[model samples]
Target: MQIILAATPVVLLIVLLGFLKLPGEKSALITLGATILIAIFGFSLSFGDTALSIGYGVTKAVFPILVIILMAIYSYNVQVKSEKIEIIKQQFSAISKDKSVQVLLLTWGFGGLLEGMAGFGTAVAIPAAILISLGFKPMFSAVVSLIANSVPTAFGAVGIPVIVLAREVEMTDQITLISSHVVWQLAVLMFLVPFLIVTLAEKSVKSILKNILLSVLVGTVTLAVQYYAAVYIGAETPAILGSIASVVVIIVFGKLTANREVKDSYLNFSFNQIFQAWSVYGLILLLVLLTSPLFPFTAFMKANWDIFQTNFNFNVAGTLHTVGIYWLTDTGVLIFVSSLVGGLIQGLSLGSLFSLLGKTTIQLKKTVVTVCCLISLSTLMDFSGMITVLGLALATATGALYPLFAPAIGALGTFLTGSDTSSNILFGKLQATVADKIGADKGWLAAANTTGATGGKIISPQSIAVATTACGQQGNEGVILKKAVGFALLYILIAGIVVYLGS
Candidate 1:
């Protein structure tokens, strides 16, 4: 009965969003209300605690999460208004006329780079928008970007997810080991995603067979580079370096295999024009790298500049949660600044840029509400101990087979919270504890949580919201979710098999 009660909100969300085909905003709002009621009555959480959790969730959602989504969409809108995205689309077409090749380049390569650098929602929003502009179907573009965004997430935002997992499990000394475990667990899925992207784009088995070599080459490159980086370099640089390598491989492969007409089309653009069109993203990358943990500037600022940071503390059901916001160094701020400067470079006036930002905000109003509600629901579950109960129940029920379900717990956390880092924080310690009880390898099980989170990302409502907003398919999140859920389940199943066998 307790397990059933704890699971009600999740079930309600799927029914309303997937089966009822309701708009995300409506479904999230309804499910959030149900979660609040359950927390108060079923879980015996006090009203004050429930209210505090909701407030904290709303604050966290607005700051870094919603801020990232807004800036990503606004940046794309600024480019569209300036006609830079048009040239950008032409640049991609010039690289490869084959839609399958283009899909791999944009979604798997460039999308992974974005996820590695800035994460939050930029990976899905930016790449999905670019794919739509390049003439892919809107739903296809959203789903493929979501799929591509998965594996890179373990190292996203300079490996914050894995870093947080280490901290949560109190095994910071073994981070390199944990990082290696994560990449190894993700090895098979990393290779599988490229083939899936190509097949989805071409909608034919023949297309995948024709581009089989490219897919195989890309998968092997990403996996090998990422594994070496994780093992030798630590967590911060694997996704960054791996994605850079993938992009290079794809460009070189396109060049070597190009027909004369395609080669000429690629050469039509001037270096300056291409630079101007891509400046927004380039600036974002530059700014993110400058402030990333790979550099000392971020550490210096955090140590010396207290004024640039905002921290809020909330006590929910006897547990204290701290939410921090870095005003000067936040990726969303950098993205917004980059977009403004890039827009000016493309010849848009200051007033025009501001106008576009305002319009973009209005366009994403529904998305903002949906994300807030979903975050609030996650917060309520956490503070009420509902999520812990579900995790413990699953561990107890599985017993000797617990390793098979470890990844699913991680996936469930991400599905509820819409974040890999948050999922790690929620379940990393629990996985370690369960592993010890079952006499399994604790580090491997903890890493499995992170690997499984990549799968959960596909069906996350917050991710779906970002995708829909990016592709101009805002009210059709249910349709997109229905289409992508199958792939998400398949991904989790594979992760489960790998983890079970390894254990």
Candidate 2:
């Protein structure tokens, strides 16, 4: 009875967000409030402890995400005000003449770029909008974009899933991260699979999936370099490194392909055009690099912040957890600086710049709130032990098939919440602990969990929302999810089989 009621919020969230097309923020708040009431009266946790637990739950999530979200918002603002992002997108003009390459590049390569730089479904949303603009049907654009977004998720935001999983599984340092680094880097290589499909659809796939071969060949090099980075240099930079590597690969491949075919269209973008358009992209890369371990960029950037932080520890009904939370200006500061820099470079006024920020905020309010609420509720469930209890029950039900379900569990968490990092937090440690108790290969199990979770990226309600918004199907995400459910499930099953075979 306790478990069922305790699990109500999650189940409700899934159904409401996933099925009913309810707004995520409202559902999360309603469900969270209900869970709190149950925890207080039915489960009999004290009011203060319940409140503290909720606070702690939200705290764990907010710290890491705040900067990420703020960076995304600011970066977006910079893109719009400076017109530099427009210049970058202009590179796709020649390709847009062919729907196939349009889908392939924007949906796959561009998707990976967004996933690497600013994950959390924006990859899907932003790209879907571009695809829609390029003349694809809205639903198809949403579906393809959703599918394309998966490959880079394992390494999204600099391999955050593995990092979260590593910390949860108690890996203090290098030993914990190498394999995960390899996993995500490998996932980056897998990105080519979707690209090949997009190519096939484009009819430019040469009847033999030629682009796939090229992608795979290039992916191999990217993965090889990324693995080296993870094991020897640093796991933290895998996404950034791999993305840069793949971009170079694509540019080379483009040159080779164009040289062989000698298409006049490819020759259109002049040196000046390339320079003007890629400036913002270069700046984006610069900002991200500054935040790398190889540099003191993030630290230097963070130094300008005025942060309000609080730490608290507690024993809640004999269960213990500690909390650290921050309201920092780091991400906001980066965005502010970037916006100013980008605007100045593009010749925008101070008033116009503020207007861009305002418009971006107004547009993003619902998205940010939905994301924040989901994090708060998810964290609360985790901190309260409710998620563990429910997961244990589900794990018992799966029995020997737990391996298949492991990633599914991660995927399921992501499906509801729409963030892979959040999913890792929800299930990464729980899966590892179970694998150990059951004597499964820890590496294989970890891989399965990660792989399965990546598959769920497509069907996720939040992802659907991003896709719909990007595709301009704003209020009809549920329908988009329905169109996508078939592929999402197919991919999920395929990933499961792959994990099972490897295990």
Candidate 3:
């Protein structure tokens, strides 16, 4: 009964969003209300506790999550308004006429770069929008972006997910070991996702054979770079450097294989014109790198500015829940600033820039409400002990076979919370405990949690919301989810097998 009650909200959400094809905002709002009722009556949670939990969740949803989505869309809007996206599309076309190669470069290579640098949905939102602008179907753009966003998530936001997992499980001393385990667990998928996205884009098995060499090259380079970086350079730079390497390889590959006509198109643009067209993204990358973990400015800001950080504590159902916000370091602020400056550089006036931002906010209002409600639902479940009950039940049921199911647990957390880092926090310690009970390597299982969370990102409603909104398919989230769920399941199944064998 308790387990059923704990899972009711999730079940209801799936039915409404996945089956009934309801709008995300309506579905999430309905589920949130149901969750509140369950928490208050079924779980004996007080009204005060429920309210506090909702507050914390709303704050979190707005600051880094919704804010990031808002700004990412605004940045794209800035490009469209300034007519730079047209030039950007032409530049990509010049690189390769094959849609498969274009999809591979944009979704797999460039999307991974965004995930590594800033994450928080920039990977899915920015790249999906760009793909749509480049003439891909909206649904195709969203689904492929979601798929490509998966593997890079383990090291996203400069490796915050793994770093948080290490901290949560109190294995900071073994961070290197844990990072290596995560890369290995994700090894096969990292190499194969490029092929998956390309085939899906081309809509044919023949496309895989046709582009086999390029796919293999991309997969090999990305996997090798991530493995070495995770093992030697530490967790902070693997995704960042690996993604950069993927981009470089694709460009070089495209150049060497270019037809005379394609080469002519590439030559039609001056270096300055190309730079101006890509200036928005360039500024975003530069800003992200400057404030990334590799830089001293990030540390200096956190140390010198008290207002750069915000933390709120809520006593929910007798437990303390703290929501922390890092303002200055947030990807949203960086992207927002970069887009504003980039727009100005592209000849847009300040008035027009603010006008674009306003329009963007209006366009994404439904997404805002949906994200907030979903986050609040997750928080209520956590505060009411529903999530713990579910996790423990799965661990106990699987027992010795828990290794095969470890990634599923991580995926569940990400599905509920919509973040790889938050998923790790929710289940990292539980994974370690289960490892001890089942005689598995603690680090391996803990790392599996992060790896699994990456797969979950593919189907996370928060992720779907961002993708749909970016591609101007907001109300069709269910259509996209229905298409994406199969890939997400396959990803988790493969992850589970890898973890099981490795364990």
- Tens digit of lDDT per residue, candidate 2, span 1-503? 86797678867865766688776556666777777777677666677777777666555444444434444444555665566666555566543344555566666666677677656554676566666655568888878878877757776766667677667666646433535533542354265454544554565435346556656755675576566666765545555566567656655555555533445655465776565555544555556545544566545545554255445676656777765433332333444565566666666677887777677656655555555566656655665666667777878988887766676677776775567777777777787788898888665565555566677888776566556544546556556666777776766666665655555
Ranking by TM-score: 1, 3, 2
Q: Relative to the unseen true structure, what is the C-alpha lDDT of residue 261 in candidate 2, on a scale of 0 to 100? A: 42
Clashing pairs in 2: none
Model 1 Cα lDDT, one tens digit per residue, 421-455: 99998899999999888799999999999989999
Candidate 1 weakest lDDT stretch, 10 residues: 203-212
Angstrom error at residue 159, model 2: 3.0
Cand. 1 Cα-lDDT? 0.91
Off by over 4 Å in 2: 23-30, 49-86, 117-122, 132-141, 173-215, 218-223, 254-262, 267-273, 297-332, 464-472
Which stretches in model 3 have alpha-carbon errors above 4 Å? 307-311, 318-320
TM-score of candidate 3 relative to the true fold: 0.97
Q: What lDDT would candidate 3 get against the real structure?
A: 0.90
User: How far is 108's C-alpha from truth in model 1 (Å)?
Assistant: 1.1
User: If both were scored by TM-score, which would come out higher, candidate 1 or candidate 3?
Assistant: 1
TM-score for each candidate, following the candidate numbering: 0.98, 0.80, 0.97
